[model samples]
Target: MNIAITPFFRTLGEVADVQIGPFGSLLHKADYIAGGIPVINPMHIAPDGIAADPEFSISDEKAASLKRYHLEAGEVIMGRRGEMGRCAVVLPEHAGMICGTGSMKIVPSPEKLIPEYLVHILRSPRARRELENAASGVTMLNLNATALKGLQISLPPLEEQRRIAGILDAADALRRRRREALALLDTLPGAIFAEMFGDPRDNPLGYPARKLSDLCSRITVGVVIKPASYYVDDGVPALRSVNVREGGFDLKDLKYFSQQTNDGPLKKSKMKKGDVVIVRTGQPGRAAVVDEEIAGANCIDMLIASPKEDELLPYFLEAFLNSDAGRQMALSNQTGQVQQHLNATALKGIDFITPPIEEQREFTRRLDEIRRAKENLTTHLGELETLFASLQSRAFAGDL
Candidate 1:
């Protein structure tokens, strides 16, 4: 059953006070200091909430100069650049923090709008689409105070707004817990590695160390050619730095290459099962093994290591490279002053302990078990996300 109510509407400007953050010229690089007030930027507006970096904090003197930019409890902080729908409510602890150049602050009138409800509405898919349409810029979408203020908002009675917000909050809480559980599951593989083989740096078991190249048949870079020029609507998927996670592949935002490109220039970069793809630049040192599902996929600017089955298992080598000790070794070999990267030559020279093939196989079996559990949890999380989206849609449609 559905109940329909004629809700009065108002422009965001009428029901709230909206203001953009300080201009870039107002807050220079020198203004930033350690152990000071944190600035809430677009990048800091995470999916979970605002994750302020202390490194971007400013001193009290600097903050006082920008006093008008300080955040207050219950206010909404929204990203003004890059992606739309990036927002979070300022909590009690976040009060006194400064707004960043890439953000905007919104304080809704309590009599007309509930801050939580407004945040929920702004984060909804429809609102995001409206915002994207209202935003300017072809390459980087941006929202100005005028654009934000002109946006129309549905204003149901106060109690109805609370009802919708409460329902959405409960659903969102479930999703958050599901994500937290998945994160906990992600740590199991590393823990297993630590328990079986002590840190490679310490070599507590006194395992013999060997050059990474000695254990691999081939170590090389992925397609160095400009891969974007070879993109196609449908063909072999081309993995990039974004596709690789710390211990796994994200597989989102993947570009594709035409079959012609795959057979021609991309032939050398075509991956096979058991090969490892390591990030080269953005987030260096992260590596993940190529499973059968994506065996024939191509990659761009990645470090590919084809481990010899006799000397080192692909899973074992990937775990080593992603381990704390392995990351330190990789970092030591990092090149490039502006953007640190791990080249094939540097990766080949990395020193790591050589565990017995039988022990490596045992670890692989345990890791496979953990992966299966993760897959199940991941599927459940996907379902929860769908349910939340549906709830948001219904709630905003006056169908809840």
Candidate 2:
């Protein structure tokens, strides 16, 4: 195959019309009306596509006033502020919606570029890097229409563009299916919990009610005094409220504390495998178990619950804390005028009906299987992403 790399690079402005979204000053909160035209903002530009927030919409009357911002099918909507390279192609369903204050519209010239191919090009890592480097802002990066329009692309024949886009679309679809599988697996643990124990709210199983303190050996708060001072380049990992997900941990942006600190002042906050850590403030009931990966980790501003092991299992407690009834119980007991936080006292007092130890073990067994499946699916999804990225690089380099 002959590799063609010459006489193809063209500025985006030559192939597409780039226009900034409406200014914040032009769209006020008061202009938003329920059941109105959807506004596509930076947050709305999700990995799959536009995830519109109903609250951030404008009335048809309000949308009419900003006619220039009206979207047309086949146009690409890109976020102009904060994270760069977030964009989605407007489908027929999205037509007539308004572009939001933090986004911009890119209308590709059909003869020069197809919307599908253009979306892939802009979403590529190289394009994202260019946008990030060119964006300007002191606090948060912002993309200007001029800079966006000036971006260059290795233009290919329409037939070749369609072929590459089709290949990438297929690979992306596989990744999406894997992701959907993982999402479904995530819901399994909750379903099992409901089936085994019934809703904790009603205790339909007629299990005996008990405070969390009665089941746990101890309940306490993690290191809360000047935790920032213990930051180190690399040492014992420290868990924070941000790291706690509903039923797992998000290790991204994890901070480390000196081992000396972990063994000394923060020793009380040290977590062992099977320990449960709950969020203290923002997103108050979210919790996760301390797995072997971060078994000896120390935490900050989290409520640590050590299961008796003989009576209760950490996995079971973690699942319950993430359940609907558990969340409501946490929220109802939360105290604080400014931040509404769940403290050790509040967590210890939260009541739930205790199931038999044998039943608890059975529930944890099912949870383990679901989580293992999720891990395998997650690994496959990552591999598919790497393959898709390679295809994007090659296709744009005129090598595919």
Best candidate according to TM-score? 2
User: How do all models score by TM-score?
Assistant: 0.82, 0.89
lDDT, model 1, position 210: 94
lDDT of each: 0.87, 0.88
Report model 1's TM-score to 2 decimal places. Answer: 0.82
Clashes of 1: 0
- lDDT of candidate 1 over 1-400, digit per residue (tens): 8777678778999999999999968998888888889999999988667899999999998899999999999899999998998998898989999999999999989899888888888888878888999999999999999999987778898889998899998989988998898899788878889999989888999999999999898888888777778988889999999888876787778899988888887788889999999988877889999998889999999988999998899988888878877877876743523237778877887777998999999999998998888899899989989988887776556566
lDDT of 2: 0.88
- Minimum summed lDDT over a 10-residue window in model 1 is located at 331-340
C-alpha RMSD of each candidate structure in angstroms: 4.0, 3.1
Model 1 CA deviation exceeding 4 Å by range: 1-6, 21-70, 96-102, 210-214, 225-233, 253-269, 280-284, 330-352
